[model samples]
Target: MKTVLITGCSSGFGLETAGYFLKQGWKVIATMRTPREDLLPRSEHLRLLALDVTDAESIHHAVEAAGPIDALVNNAGIGLLSAIEGTSMDLARDIFNTNTFGTMALCKAFIPQFRQRKSGVIINVTSTVTLKPIPLLAVYTASKAAVNAFTESLALELAPFNIRVGLVLPGLAPSTDFGKNAASRMQNVFPEPYEAFAANFFANAKNTAVVTYAADVAHAVWQAVNDPSAPMRIPAGADAVALAAQSL
Candidate 1:
């Protein structure tokens, strides 16, 4: 069976994707900052590991625990809803640390193994907002944009080695803690011009019916990892697809 390592399995897209792969008979290493039994569906093929992408030591240990993985899914990320002025420099750093640098580190750590074997795929979970500025979530959008750019660069770099680098840019899914996490920072970031609009915009970002379900993203991820010709970028939601079409 193929082996896939998925980070951030505590809930949302991560957990759903883990279960999907496990059900498909892949050996899955599902990880989270805090691994909880309740967050995952009980499965024989599922191997749980504790991982904090923002924590270097945790990443190293989880990678070691996972051993040789055929595919690496970089999905662990945090959100900050505050605007430029009200948001702390430290807060921006923290978000970038998790969403951008942490993911880059994971790819760096795993690509060596993939290269040695002359095989493997890397799927980085990004966002659709990079297509346009979604008002107050500029920091979050920039973070994902970094991932998108990294994915494109890595795709070209890895292609010569027979390793694939692909990305899934999911539009906001309501059934996730992401919006709440973003909202939590609202009190801090909502300043003058942005204060009036932040709430509804952020909510609409994840209003389920307005977007696709997490399973849609999970399925796209599975397809991206398995398909020989998966595109460098896979739009994981209808919103993403429509927006991508518009951008084109």
Candidate 2:
């Protein structure tokens, strides 16, 4: 059976993707900052490991423990909803650390192994905001946008070794913990002048009917990992799909 190592299996798309892979008869190594055995179904093909993507030591340890894997899913990420001026350098750096650097670090850890094997897949979970600009998510967009570029470039470089790179651009998921986490950390987000705009934007976003779900993203990741000829960027939701079409 093929093995896949996924990051950020604590919840949302990561958790759902892990379950999907397990159901498909693949050995799954689900890594999260805090592993909860109860979160996933009990299966002999499943293993849970603790991983803080932002911490180098944690990533190194987790990858070492995961043994050989056929695919790497870079799904661990944090959301930020703050204006540029209001967002401190530290806050911006933190967002990049997890969403950008963390994914790259994990890729670096596995690249040698993948090259040696001459076969592997890297699926990165980015955001649709990179395709369509959003107001309050400038920082978040920038971070994911970097990953989009990185994936595209890496795909070209890794093609010689037959390693595939894919990107999943998921739309806004109001029902997921991502919205709650972003809201909870927005205390220092908007300046006084932009408060009204931020409020209206969020309220509209929540009430919108075009939100994506964990399953949709998980399926997209599965498709990306399995389809060797898949596009570098795959839209994982209705909203993202519509936007991507318009872009073309």
- Candidate 2 — which pairs collide? none
Q: Give the 10-residue window scoring lowest on summed lDDT in candidate 1.
A: 201-210
TM-score of each: 0.94, 0.98
Model 1, residue 74: what's the lDDT?
Answer: 94
* Model 1 lDDT per residue over 98-143, tens place: 9999999999989889999999999999988888777667788899
Query: Any idea what lDDT model 1 has?
Result: 0.86
What TM-score would candidate 1 get against the native?
0.94
Best by TM-score: 2
Residue-level lDDT of model 2, residues 141-182, one tens digit each, is 999999999999999999999999999999988767887766
Candidates in order: C-alpha RMSD to true structure: 1.8, 0.9
Q: Supply candidate 1's per-residue lDDT for 151.
A: 89
Relative to the true structure, how large is the alpha-carbon lDDT of every model?
Answer: 0.86, 0.91
Count of clashing residue pairs in every prediction: 1, 0
